[model samples]
Target: MGRQRTKPAPTPPTTTRGRRTRDGLILAGREILEQRGWSAFTPEAVAQTAGVSYGTFYTYFESRDDLLHHVVRSVAGEMLAASLVSPDGVDDPYARLVESNRLYLRAWDRASKVLRLVDQGAAADEALRQIVHEIRDFYVGRATKGLRRLQDAGLANPDLDPRLTALALGSMVEQVAHARSAMEEPYDEDTVVDHLSRLWASAIGLQGAPDEGWAARARATAGTASD
Candidate 1:
């Protein structure tokens, strides 16, 4: 009888060392983009900064755009995490909205540079543009839910469409945040927060007078975050 053929061994899974190398490359790429902007970002520079060989970069990322895609996703994840706020204890709808807006602004400020790069890259690449749209959809969904809750509670305008209003609010906030974060002129964070919160309150038809202390609370929260 003929001897049975042996099955080949399964390929090894990625080891801790390989994972570390990939993470290092990604971190290095982010640093490069943050310090030198997208114009100077390159796979070679990232590999060199990460102390990994050029071939190692290929082992993880297919191309420069692939690496950048990972970076954008990572930054977007951070922004999403930062934007999440629990309004359980906050009794006032308008106050909750203020806190939510403040958190969004802080997240945007933290990731402003990377977000700008994403915007530019998205404009030039379809894949990147899809990623940007996904992020926008996430924020819009959150806004829609919040508005719906307000409407149910009789705090928001009953006639307004939640989804449409969410889209408009999201677009306005994102553009304003991007512009303000990039401006060279020093601007007060509290003032911006106040203006945005009040605008949202008015647009949503929030009941009762706007809380005058929301800006101070937002500033205090921001200070704590920085510390």
Candidate 2:
């Protein structure tokens, strides 16, 4: 033979279940974060937990950070969606803020490790930093817009700065999440939500503890729907 022929490598079979496999991996990764923390996370661990081969993990993600990127995006999406857009829908500013605070607490409680990993990664990786920033900016933009609306409607003080308020609220949420992650004490959801609501309320110029009716209602509804 004057010439030799070479065949291309065969493509790996992955997620014969398609998106379900990737979704399963993400779910498994979240479970790992919750159970083992970031220090214990690895591709091998997640693959074993997901009941998929190591090759399968690579098929869905290039690396551990890649899988974590997906998890953080999903968590951020859920948190943003749960934010209150209008106080009128909740009866008052205090109620609305409390509800929003509660939602943030729930998201943070479940995603604390993921959030911490994102922060740590962002410190070293430009791409990850940008992704984290985009996620924060999206939430802050929505909050600023919502606060502007409240101000225009006379629910928020006319003299209040929406941008600063948005940043303040975001900081408050992140700080509480960081605190919970640092502590080993088992505080319940209601306790966390109550404290978060008070923090947010006091930051926005509210004189006392915020009304928690909206938060209670949202928690009850979320529980019922999940059931």
Superposition error at 118 for model 1 (Å): 1.6
Model 1's lDDT to the true fold? 0.81
Please report how far candidate 1 places residue 156 from its true position, in Å. 1.0
On a 0 to 100 scale, what is the lDDT of residue 22 in model 2? Answer: 83
Candidate 2's error at 41, in angstroms? Answer: 2.8
Q: Estimate each model's TM-score.
A: 0.83, 0.71
lDDT of 1 by residue, 1-227 (tens): 11222434323228998778777888888899999987777878898899987767777876677789888888889999998887565877777777888899999988888888888777779988998999999999989998898889887789999999999988888877977888753667788778888887777777763754566789999999999
| Residue 48 alpha-carbon offset, candidate 2, angstroms | 2.0
Report how far residue 77 has shifted in candidate 1, in Å: 0.3
RMSD of 1: 11.3
List of clashing residue pairs for candidate 1 = none
